[model samples]
Target: MLASLYKNNHGTIAEYKRIFSSSPAEVWNVLTNNENLKLWMDHLEITDLRKGGNIQFHFHDDLGTVEEITITDFEEGRVLEFEWGKDFVRFEIRPEEEGTQLLLKQVLTEITDHTPKDLAGWHVCLFHFADVVNNEKNHYPENEWEKWYEKYREIMK
Candidate 1:
């Protein structure tokens, strides 16, 4: 599903919500564990996991580009918020009666030409997250992202 975009005092916020049939513990494990994380977001790795620690984004290119993002807030099982360039990306997990509810919000300071790409990327990643949580194996859907990117581009315009 497309993330809902809205404005706030800090800036624009792109919010995504997903419900998983997995338990909260299972969902959190997939969200934070490195092995599971790679299945959804191959570029991101948790180098350090505390509030002041870092999450690194590796480009995996010939240049081997890497950027460190600080963990701004963390509560072991419930919340994880970190710096996303100048913005913030946060994940909040709640236990639901039927399963788990995962909420992801990216706080954007300004919408740029690249904003649609980021939003579409996250939208695709969330779909992967659901599959990972359900133990369903599949290849990354590059074509799906292109379709979402176009949708996001139209929305941004």
Candidate 2:
């Protein structure tokens, strides 16, 4: 699904929602566990899992800057949010009859030249995340990522 972008007090909020047939606990595991998290978003790891805890965002290509982002909000299986550079990244989980509903929101302080690329990467990650939750191998779809990048560019413009 495409992310919806809107202005907020701080900046813009780009939110993406997904539904999974996996239970909330199952989905939560995919989002929080270090092993499962690496499968979806390789650059990120949760060093701690509570408010004021930290998450490491590594730049594999850059290798020089490893950001230990502070957790701004957290709940065992319901919510996890943290600083992402100058912005914030949040994941909210809720139980559904079949499985769980997950909302991933990235708070953007500005729509810079990199904004579209960042949003596209997120759209791709969530796409791969759904597959991993279903026990499939992690696959980054380059075509889909390109498509999303163009969509985000048009939206930002």
Candidate 3:
């Protein structure tokens, strides 16, 4: 089962929990490698896969400019954390019966009208993560993210 919760305030926090059908090491590889990331996430350039290594992702397109993120922390087969603008995000992995348990959290430091859009974006992206682990191609819904953000902004008010 997968679940998520979000609270909008000085910062917005979103958390997602799910059980995956893969080992923590396998899942960790998908999460840490830039090549695998390109399959599921925005194009990425990771300097190193060590704790405190620099990480950056680019979503450059006609819609907008670059979306660069920095890696804050990393624990092999366990956890990874990063920052995007004023937002902080983390991914935590644990052992589970069938495979691995994954938890993803994103904290944004500022309550904007964009809260709903942000949450929805995470929702879609997280599901994409699940898809990749399940052996499906990870295709991000960039257009959907924009559309949902508009709808979410309206709902946030």
Candidate 4:
């Protein structure tokens, strides 16, 4: 069964799912490898992929950083779970008819409020993931990004 977003002692949780044309191994590599992650995700440092390992993400746009995410779980080519700040981020991969289905769950612990900016950033990031996996020459446009950011600010407030 799919994990549901729930409010717990920590915070709120958000879930997202997407199907990619790449194999599960490829997706797993992209998620785990720092160089491949940078192609889509922000700059990141992964100390290791084992349980109890630590990972860090640095936002390219603002110099903001996500430090010390402990690897709570890891299943080769299948699942990965880590503690990101007060939240937990989990990625699950399943083989599909075309390629693979990736389920991303972000458990927002300690964050009491929901903001559109947060959602918008996630939406854009997923779009970028799709674009990169599809080997598109140009990912998302600047105007589109600006629009999403604007919507984020407007809706968050």
**What is the lDDT of every predicted structure here?**
0.92, 0.90, 0.73, 0.71
Best by TM-score: 1
Q: In terms of TM-score, how similar is model 3 to the real structure?
A: 0.77
The reply for model 4, stretches above 4 Å from the true place, is 1-11, 59-66, 110-114, 141-157
Indicate the worst ten consecutive residues by lDDT in candidate 2.
136-145
**lDDT for each residue of candidate 4 in 1-157, tens digit (9 for 90 to 100):** 1223556665666677888889988888877777767777675678788888778766655657566678999888898898765667788999999999988878765544444445556667777777667777564675565666566455334
Q: Would you list the clashing residue pairs of candidate 1?
A: none
lDDT of 2 by residue, 61-145 (tens): 7556787899999999999999988999999999988889999999998779999989999989987798789988665555777
TM-score of each: 0.95, 0.92, 0.77, 0.75
Q: CA lDDT of 122 in candidate 3?
A: 72
TM-score of candidate 1 on Cα atoms, chains taken together: 0.95
**Candidate 2 wrongly placed segments (more than 4 Å):** 62-65, 138-144
Where does model 1 exceed 4 Å of error? none
How many clashing residue pairs are found in candidate 1?
0
Highest-scoring model, lDDT: 1
